[model samples]
Target: MKKTAYITGGSKGIGLGIAEALLKEGVSVAITARTQNDLVETEKHLKTIGDAEVLIIKSDVRNLADEEKAIQQVVDKWGGLDFCIANAGVGRFSPIDEMSAEDWNSVIDINLTGVFNTVKAAIPALKKSKGYIFTISSLAGTNFFENGAAYNASKFGVVGFSQAIMLDLRPYDIKVTTIMPGSVATYFNGHTPTDADAWKIQPEDIGQMVVDLIRMNPRTLPSKVEVRPSVPPSARK
Candidate 1:
């Protein structure tokens, strides 16, 4: 049977990398985000990777209704869902005193509550198929820093929320994992990957990691994975 996967924030960067890798392996994957242009571009790129097994969905993780609809569409088209990846996230880096209410809420809404909505929306189909879930958290989730208060809080919540859900869903034979990546070269925070960023982890590395996790033995569950660049820019210099 052909397995199906749903991914949030799948238009670019790590999400797109994962989608491309899965599609290449013949996984019917659906990716959702709010940007129409990015979705169009990603879908086109993915088509070159495989057949027309990729679906582009315009959705915002902050809205439960949107997530529910996106999941339903994939399930309807694919017969079932075997994987759900909560990778949509945003970062607002400002000191506690300088951040506004909107800044805090935006980060929390997309990075924290967003994961809640993604997994919650997929549970029914996931329960039926004994699916696997991957939460794209950050190393900042565990380590704290100045000028990163909002981002840190949201990622920390992601780490905690996913850990708790792993327990909740384990009884149903559903596997949950949180991926805390360190310094990946991607388009996060409006920055593009370039030659200068070569020392950081590549999005494709994380993509391959997801495939490896899903391919692991059914009896084994690696619920948390932390991936970092083998060498930092400073060390490489």
Candidate 2:
């Protein structure tokens, strides 16, 4: 039987790349985002990629009800979900003293609580299918720097949450893996990708990694993975 997957924030960046990869592998996919326009455009682009079914859902990860609805829509359309990717996130960079309460809340709500909502909504279906869960974290989850208070706290919480859930879900044969990537060339944090980003890790590279993980033998599980550009700009002469 053809597998099905659900991806959050799938309109662009890492989510879109993962959707493309899964579609190429003949997995029917459902992608969610907050904007209807982006979802519609992404659906059109995905259709051109392969014959796999693409369902675009307008959803905000910060809302548990929205996430639950998104998951139900996928299951209603595709029967069962074999994978869930919690990739919706945002960055708010500022020192604690300088950060607004609104900015801090937005970052935590979307980045950390969002993951909770996505997984909570999908757990039942995943348990039944013995499926996989992929949470996107960052190197900043572990390494903190200046002006990164809110972003760091959210990602660090993601790492801890993902690990704990990995153990909790493994009992049901549900695989949970957290991927921490550094310097991906994507339109994240208001930065547009350019030729200069050629040296960084491409979003598709992370997508390919997901494909590999799905194809791995069931007996082995790589619970946590950290990926970085092999050579960063700082390393260049």
Per-structure clash totals for the candidates: 0, 0
- The residue-by-residue lDDT of candidate 2 on 19-79, one tens digit each, is 9999999999999999999999989999998788999999999999999999999999989
**Which candidate wins on TM-score?**
2
Candidate 1 structure quality by residue, lDDT tens digits, 1-237: 279999999998899889987987889999998989989988888888876388999999999999999999999998989999999999888889999999999999999999999999999999999999999999999999999999999999999999999999999999999999999889999998899898888889899999999888999988888888887866754
- Candidate 2 ranges beyond 4 A from true positions: none
**Residue pairs with backbone atoms closer than 3 Å in model 1 (clashes):** none
As for model 2, its CA RMSD to the true structure in angstroms is 0.8
Q: Which parts of model 1 are misplaced by more than 4 Å?
A: none
lDDT of 1 at 66: 97
Which pairs of residues have clashing backbones in candidate 2?
A: none
Alpha-carbon shift of residue 200 in model 2 (angstroms):
0.7
Q: What lDDT does each candidate get?
A: 0.92, 0.95
Candidate 2 residue 9 C-alpha distance from true site, Å: 0.5
